[model samples]
Target: MLNIEKTFDQITAMGPVHLKIFTYIMQMLRDKYDVSMIDFDIEKSIFFYGIDSLKIIEIHSALEARLNCKIPTEAFFQANTFKGMIDDIVKSISNDGNLGIETSHYSLETEIQEALDYLLRDRPQRDEGYQTELTHTTLLTGASGFVGTFFLKELLENTDLKIFCLVRAADEAAGLERIRKTERKYNAHLPQGWEDRVQIVIGDMSKKRLGLTDEVYQEYAKTIDSVYHVAAVDNFYLPYNIIKKTNVVGTVEVADFALEGKIKPFYHVSSCAVSLLEQCSDPPTIIGLVNGYAQTKYVTEQIILRIAEKGLPWSSFRLGYLYTLGISDVDLDPNVSFKKLLQLVAKAYDKVEDDFFIEADAFENFLMAIPEIGCVPDLDANFDLMPVEYGAKAIIKTSLLPMSELKSCYTFYNPCPLDWSDIVNYFKQSNKRIEKVPLNTFVDKYAEYVRHTDDNSIKLLKSVVSSQLDQQLNTMFRQIDTDMVKEDIHWCPPCEKQFTHAYVDFVLND
Candidate 1:
């Protein structure tokens, strides 16, 4: 057996303030709970094994009460080891003696006065050195989507670049207003006077020449230095003809416009799914088995590659699923059969069909971890998942790349390596009764169940589940080869398990 005592002694000798705090914490637990180091499995306990739900709350409460530090729940997960946990707690306590809130409760008027004083003290000071260097006017397509929203906010926050957003309709003012609302909704900390820097240009991607009249096209062509093409038909169930019209042909139109105008660079948002669905003779890579969406993305990539060969200063970013702070409100796309299965399970449980049961929230959280959510043909597959904010930051960073780097048709960016297993474990932790069925067993049982049940929902659910299992298994065997550009991407800050519990409490009470 590994010498847990020796390892812990080494950690203690490190003399990091956090390690000292942890030592104190361990002593407290030993005294109060009679929790000996021997009773805890150093490797398997909360420290090394990852934070399960209950342990996260206990740690958070302990920190607040003992050290008077208000630590975020996400911190527990990020601090995967005991040493890391101690470091974070020590930093939090040292920075502010009070855990999270002020040390003492005060009158409402006094609190308001204190808040105003703090805000004023921290206000940004204008200096010539702080002035922005970005001078060129830029154009952004697909300014409505999640990535688009984050990109717009970042540009507004960091640079003085004048932005021209492409809208589908002639009501450019209304579109711009909507963009402002979205910015405020997501980035409440945005600097004042940010909206004044943006302008909107009405143009439809589907229209030939990007729906731009000759006069407007010529004017924008002369002025705009760069174009960020973030728009695409993200739905998988949509027909090839429709997808081709928007993703491929529309892209060509934008490229043509940029080429004619002599624009320095054009940034395109492409999905990692483009590498999917190739034959065994072709180079092996994990193809997301979602459906036509992946295939269409592949075709779209070919279009860009062809354009690149002809000498267009363009760069393509292949990204995985982009999630936002807001839970997806778009009902499960029709193509996600797993969603159908969930619906079926929900219905069957209403009739008390079996002793086994799974809650809707657990199923939804599980789906979020998987690649296929808003997209169709919900295949059980792993994907590089990144928060929308991180994805946008990467796109902006890539856009700033030199013309020489823009020569390639594709440049892969992998921002987050959120393992699907971690998500599965989270769901399992949330609900202990719903045992994890092996992917094969899940498919086999689902198929058998479908044959006996005439209900359309159940049939659809089984089909989706079986297909997803097959896809997931195939992905395990097949892997794609591409040069992935890794960057230090920010993830959603870890929150305490109490936060999730709080959400659950609110939902139950409501």
Candidate 2:
């Protein structure tokens, strides 16, 4: 016989206050959704049976209201089991206890705001009375990229800057429509009259001077304050000449344009790959790679630095592996390294070799043979793992820094210091039934599995699995350095228990 009281008692033993909050949530669900064990096993239905993701958001809001705690956004994925959810709620209580944030006295908004203030202690104070007039109308290349989209969101949230996006199409109306769609997709609730805050300019980075007409260039010069150059060809396997033309020469054009316009501060997005292959004498490695992508980025960085020296207040941001919700669509282009590896693995799997072990062996050899293999050093390398949102926040915050405070031509903001080992451990723990294998071994096995599975749908499944692994790995790595960013910015903490509970409930339902 199931002892409901005893189950509740076990939860209460973990923490009395958290138990109260859980009781409140359960009661609310029962009343609102008519959810009950008899009705459909509430836990199993919500967690394992695969409730809508939007419903999870609703639950998050409900729990916050009941507990008077600001559950971190990351907690949604972390607390995927029933017990795990309760444990997370208890942990929230513990953290709040230290802050003297009593649920009985303080409103949820007040508590959330206080937490935000503490997290963003190092951020520049907002000047409410300062004239909202943006002296510079900035154009963001790759305005559709993950970093670009988040950057736009961060700007909207934190600053009064006017943004213009460079679009590939020459037609102004078509570009504006595309920008609108992007805005609606990311954030539907645009500030009243937000369209007035943005403009879409037709330009192509591949062409000379961004292919802008003289009249358009003059108008840009007169109105734009600076340009955030984020567009680049990232195909690692592409010919050196092709990469050089787009990444290197294209950057030279952008720099020249910025210089010609006398834009006060030009921002360039470089990759951490630029800091590869070269052995550094210090405790941590800082030197970059010899590969085409890294080498081109290094050259671009030098060009931007030279531009800064020649009177333009230019800043180069060396970003690391970027992870976000829509990353599969934005970051993982078909030509990128990860996608290429997946394709290779998929093709190898299709051959139907005699033994899985043989297939795995071949895949392992292929991964190892890749050039410029460098491990992410110092589990806390700031740029090693960064969430798209946090990365955007860092970029916007740094951009807003006063000219006097901006000392370096190149500034490195490591978004998060998450450990890959933590991610590997997490996967191992999550799928305990699956035998733990070394990364190389796992990759081999995965490749072999893909090869042997005859179903056509397996290709999509493999892609999804790879993307999830990338996301989890990136999250773990960012967690290593999140303390600094958390201290300096408003980022939701990981709600490990809630996500775990959710996962458990989901599995049970399935």
Candidate 3:
């Protein structure tokens, strides 16, 4: 039989540094989640143990303090597996004689290109066995996410198909509970007897075959009629290598599943950020992008396009910022730059008397901060905000179109987007204390204001401030070309009409 203690003893024999790092990780797992090191799979994602982005941040901070050296946050994220993370920690420790930045020979662009080439090879052919329409069953990934909850709602309410929700959980009961939690959180209405129409398939997208067994995987591959892949790690700060396993590799796996069964129509939810990158670069270099989230999304879209070329009926919906329909605080992506900025602004304004920043309504903090600071950053960008409900419905309706009429790409963004000045104007009318200032001026003011408080929130505020100063981020929300999408899908509802105070109250009041 296998002995975990013996293996751990062997590890401890390597070196004191290795022993310390390994011990901390093992202890953290045990103390926090009641998980033992032996039960942890070295090859699986750290998220498998319920480590979220916030937890990763906390872990990195503690490791940095213990090791007495700087560790890149991206390094932790880039480590897709537990073993990869431990290895990276050791390498960081070993090279800390000078305590300088760690350099690597890895190239992100080359990695993207190679992964794409590998996926394109031996493309699946459409035989006579292919089904022409989505009739009976469909497979949906990211059914528990913000926009995904809406996707689940749309499919259940509008279609007669049974859905196989690919969720990461310990078992079927756990997966179903996860979906129920999402439905409650997002206020998604589930029809009576809805459980009969939905099946929870416990799986991880970051793994091969989506962490499914051979028999079960093959069964779903043969039975599922279509695919909706919306699940992704949306952290903006993590680098490409870290997010590649889920965003890029998971996409490839989903495509593989789609092609394996009777050829299915693959509806991919892409990002408008890709369009922003393309417009900014004469010829975009994947490595030159500002964040890993955009890089992985770019690569995933290319993969979908290649699959479309190989006879799979695929459609990509390039969505912008997906806002809440009513403001129950469920549609927002926590990692999105816009939400982070709002939170930081809120913290800066709500400098509490304690050692930590008190949590307050982010929208309220943002609105209040403008008047106190007397200036808003002249971002000079239009927000292509789309309501979650509309985006979800649009994806479903467009995907259900006749295969021959299906366009390879459809852009979903506000046809009439609101400029930064528009939002400021609403607040200015209520409180004349605010005015538009240059970006640099706003950053300096924000930083100086945040410097007054020596707390944990200060670090996050500084990071967000520094990110705002990045030149690329300023252009991240450029006008997305939606003429083709509008013309192709004539019956599709408009994404948004105009930026109004009523709309402001709808989002900020809660």
CA-only RMSD, every prediction: 25.0, 25.9, 9.0
After aligning candidate 1 to the native by TM-score, how far in Å is the CA of 506 from where it should be? 12
CA lDDT of each candidate? 0.51, 0.50, 0.66
Q: lDDT per residue, candidate 2, 1-510, as tens digits?
A: 354565576667877775776677667567766666333332432456344444555565566655554543233334446556556556655644332111112132332334334322432322222212336467677765545766666666666768888778758788766655554444322345656767877887767767889888766755676778887876433223436667866776676566553444677888765544223221222111223455567667756665456544677877665443222223233345533533433443344334321211211222222211221111221224344555666776777777656544443344334333443344445545444443445444443444443332332122222313443334323443322333333232132433333322322232
Enumerate clash totals for all models, in the order shown. 14, 43, 1
- In terms of TM-score, the best-performing candidate is 3
TM-scores, one per candidate: 0.53, 0.50, 0.69
Instruction: For residue 356, give model 2's deviation from the true position in Å.
Output: 37
lDDT per residue for candidate 1 within 369-398, as digits (tens), equals 222221112234444534465566666765
lDDT of 3: 0.66
TM-score of 1: 0.53
User: Distance (Å) between predicted and true CA of 489, model 3?
Assistant: 11
Residue 177, model 1: lDDT of 69
The global Cα lDDT (0 to 1) of model 2 is 0.50
